[model samples]
Target: MTAPLHWKLVIDTTDAQTLADFWAAALGYEVEDQSRLIAQLLSSGDLPEAAVTEHDGRRAFRGLAAVRHPEDPYDAFTGIGAGRRLLFQDVPEPKTVKNRLHIDVHAEPDGRDDLVARLETLGATRLREVNQGPAGHWWVMLDPEGNEFCVA
Candidate 1:
């Protein structure tokens, strides 16, 4: 039998921490706390001061942040998720093309509208509403940095 590979979705953004926070709140996930790891690396002179930033009053990597499913296991020392996770990394260039991949958020049918509204309040923008006559109905939304995702 073949073994399944573990993976996390990585997204490029202009502001990693901001996007990570938005995704964490939108998906009911938790932002990975790497303060301890950052401190350890800094103390060891392995990570430079320029590579660090502060988020929510805690040390974080300057151009990186991540969110993970609350129930997932993770490395205690490094604060890296071992299961479902999303990593956001900063890139110099702006997104110029439509995404080849996107995330679809499934909500209770009765609560989808509320969920969309809540996402909007979290800095997501409603791009459009998509209805497929019976297959499904969903809202196409853009995250704070304009990455596309769906609320279904």
Candidate 2:
């Protein structure tokens, strides 16, 4: 039998909440909140008080947050599985180099340039422009965090 295919992508970040917020707003997705589980555990005495951590002047459950396409399916209770999703996991160190894999977004006919401009307004910077064989063109850009993505 073939294994089930999963459709989620993950990124490492020093601040998962910040990344979650940026991506949620940029992609029109909602941030996943696991605090309900954390709170339930705390109230049921199943989790230690130390399990929760403060982040960015807000209380975070510690470790992970994600954003997903609004129309994509995901479990509301667990916020797990089945979506075009971006997950940000907390790490002690910051990203120091270019990403080996990144995302590219395609826009509607005649809408790419406008999309690029809008993205720039949102803190993405154009890195370069390229024109290839037979009328193909694209712009390489970097996100606020320096991750690269192409607009075409």
Candidate 3:
């Protein structure tokens, strides 16, 4: 028998909190809070002081933040998530090249042009317009943090 898949996408970021906020606003998801994990790590002294940080005046784990689909299942206390989600994990370096794998959003009603406008308002900028003869039209757009996605 074929195996059932289990998955979520993780994106690397220098600032997890900021990236989480940006992605949540853009995708209409809520940020996952991992305060308990932070607390446990801090109290046990397993985490170094340098690995914890204050962002906007609140203590946060320096490495990660996540956003999940509103209707999707998540553990109430820890926010371990299931369903459409993007996890942003902090890294010291910046993203240096184009994404090898990216998302393509299909337009529901009036089509690609209309979807492009909505995405623009959400801080995605158009990269290029591609016309696929019989297949359809698409726009290559970049998210606020420069990750690419297609509107088609």
lDDT of each: 0.96, 0.78, 0.81
Backbone clashes under 3 angstroms, per model = 0, 0, 0
Off-target runs (Cα >4 Å) in candidate 3 are 54-58
Give RMSD (Å) of candidate 3 vs. truth.
2.4
Clashes of 1: 0
11-121, model 2: which lDDT tens digit per residue? 887777777787776667877656667677788998888867765554556677778888888787666546788988877877788889988888789998998888887
Tens digit per residue, CA lDDT, model 3, 13-52: 7778887887787667888776767777788998887887
Q: After the best TM-score superposition of candidate 2, give how far the Cα of residue 39 lies from its true spot, in angstroms.
A: 1.8
Ranking by lDDT: 1, 3, 2
Q: lDDT, candidate 3, residue 90?
A: 79
Query: Pairing residues by index, what is the TM-score of model 1?
Result: 0.98
Q: Encode model 1's per-residue lDDT on 1-152: one tens digit a residue.
A: 98999999999999999999999999999999999999999999999999999999999999999999999999999999999999999999999998999999999868999999999999999999999978989999999998899999
lDDT (C-alpha) at residue 18 in model 3: 82
Off by over 4 Å in 2: 1-3, 46-59, 133-135
Measured with C-alpha atoms, the lDDT of residue 92 in candidate 3 is: 81
Which one wins by TM-score: 1 or 3?
Answer: 1
